[model samples]
Target: MEILNSKEMIYSPTENREEKLSITGRVTFLSMVAGSVLALTNFISNSALAEDVIKIGTPLALTGGLADEGKKQQIAYDMWLRRVNAAGGINVGGKKMKVKLVAYDYQTDGKRAGQLTEKLITSDKVHFLAAPFGSGHTKITAGVAERHGVPIVASTASSLSVYNQGFKNIFGTLAPNTGMTEAMMKFFKKKLPGTQKVAVLGRDDVFPRAMAKSLSKGARNRGFDVVYDELYAVGTLDHASSLSKIKSEKPDWIYLTGYTQDLILLRKQMSDLGVTAPIVTMVTGPAYKEFVDGLGKLADGVTSSSWWHHATDYKSDDVFGSTKAFYTQFVKEQGHDPDYVHASAAAALIVLQKGIEKAGTLNRAKVRDAIASLDIVTFFGPIKFSPNGMNQVRDLPIIQVQKGKVSVLHPADIKNAEMQKM
Candidate 1:
């Protein structure tokens, strides 16, 4: 398998022996060059060997609509790789085994992603697997992993539907979609009790639509009038028609759910169409700094909720030790603030590492059991998998962008600022 993000730290094991040959062309060994040739040959031989290593295969959408999110995942994985190698790798049966990540670019095609996942298991013989970007592609990869009896972790998938399937080999780092949606509904209702009318908009995809349905349910439960609800087609460039309808409904709050790019365009459309709401909250857009920096003044007062934030204070027994430490190192290395996506992706890798270490072996079933029964906290937060392999942590951070600052507003303990009303 081709390694898309090796970066010198990660390992790439090849099936063909010919590919491992380092010395090319004609090489004549003289009396003086004998020692140098022997040293170079030994170095090449050691680097080519993949023994005593743990290989985890992942399919990434490196060149498509999901490329930005995919790059975040790669960075998180590489961070884990560097840290693990620095600590002499994971302890397995009293031996510290180095890690090798085998990543393949699926080009954002769901079918190709599934094929690559299966190839990783059968052909590449990867010990574990990390699913693709979001719920839609992850479900496909998870199914393939299940059929092959390989344990797989999903960092970005949160839709309850993906976890509802009776799969024995799938686990996710993020909690169910209901977790974020429920947290947001309670926060909004408590902060602005007079917000009776709510409007919901989302992408017509697996995760966004599922999150919208969960948000709609939570909104109604909080005694709010669901004035308007709609799902736009994927890759929709013009949201003027949908914004006009929501504006006519005169809702007090607008809840939107979609990817980073999709929400960026949708927010610009809302501004162009004069759609105003007292509390305009988006599920995941504001989690990244690009959202605020992209729209200087328009992103003000736009609130969002995420599974984990760098501002969270938590201690972990993992490599990073604490949330603050991870954030510090991530910013130092990446030269920018990491978002919820980066946190979740790193958490997924942490889960696998803990499982392999706890089980004391590389057996798939044993590691899977260790992962499912884990009840520990990490830099990301408490991660305990339910029977269906979905994270049970519900300590979501309610956030808002006020004057270009992403601030936490709710869950009083971590609130750095109050929610700014428009």
Candidate 2:
């Protein structure tokens, strides 16, 4: 804007030509001062507006083994970002600040993920962080965030060890592995009372290994005989030998834990070896549609437990309003339904958003305090962080894939069907 106006200049009637030049000199001096003030004011306004934005940085595994899961997380983050900005951004201390997401692909390397997380803090200067895909990656990155004093939310990491490290800056969305195991154990013991023998298998990675160990303990505690408990090498292309040993066990219940591809390949290999159990359970993989797409009929009668499902009849005044509302919009935009990974990813940002709003500033310490003290309900579930920073919501959903439809089979109240025998 033009700050100095020529029409506002004063003129003296008695001034001669020489005096007029002196009057012009005074006007020029005033103009310079006026211009200086105007420039200074504009600079201050621009800087304040720039500071009002919240930049959230994340290292995603957009390539290699974790690429697919990383994309699911990206979709959730993108959806939340659009909604928050569209609603005129978050109101922080009476000032509205828009959000910007800064992300880099970590290529499924834990070391690289840690390196990028440090870079996001030192170089990108992000106000917050969303951790990488699984517990293996989140653990590596969350430590870096803690040392730098940046608040990080992990959407998928549920292993107890992830948060037991005494790091205050790290928070997770999914409840601990025990919740998933306990829910499955209770439901199976009640329904399949005759179930005696159980076999377990999992990928030799952080989250999967942790889940397998927890599930095996829970099964043994529930009086089921746990046999053939083992973990395969990470990124293994073959599980034939493992499947053969499991088949030899003649177990009534077979429990497998791994990511999407690993589960799919294991299921296919199980079919090839003619290894079929009366009750087959897989952690997490059945919650995703890709598992069914990859295995087709092989996915049927596969029971699994997840931290969330869109069919949950929960509501919130937050971003998506309710589970049904989120499901409708996600299906409309992505042309497919969302899985637990998607819901958990979106919920993680919602937690971060609430922390920022409650603290009324992007100050890292303040936001971390607000998040740590939070105990609230969301569209996904009730979240109350344990003292250790992992979600304390224990109401996990147990599901089964039947004829291409993922159905809730346990917890009695929310159950849509009973377990089917193959």
**Root-mean-square deviation per candidate:** 4.9, 12.2
Q: What is the C-alpha lDDT of each candidate?
A: 0.85, 0.85
Query: How would you encode candidate 1's per-residue C-alpha lDDT over 199-300 as one tens digit per residue?
Result: 999899898899888888888887789998889898788888889999999999999988777888888999999998999988788888888878888989
Q: Could you tell me every candidate's TM-score relative to the true structure? A: 0.89, 0.87
In model 2, residue pairs whose N, Cα or C atoms come closer than 3 Å (at least 3 residues apart or on different chains), thus clashing, are none
Model 1 C-alpha RMSD vs. true structure (Å) is: 4.9
The global Cα lDDT (0 to 1) of model 2 is 0.85
lDDT of 2 by residue, 61-161 (tens): 88888898998999999999999999988879888889878788888989989988888788667899999899889999999999999999999998888
Candidate 1 wrongly placed segments (more than 4 Å): 1-51
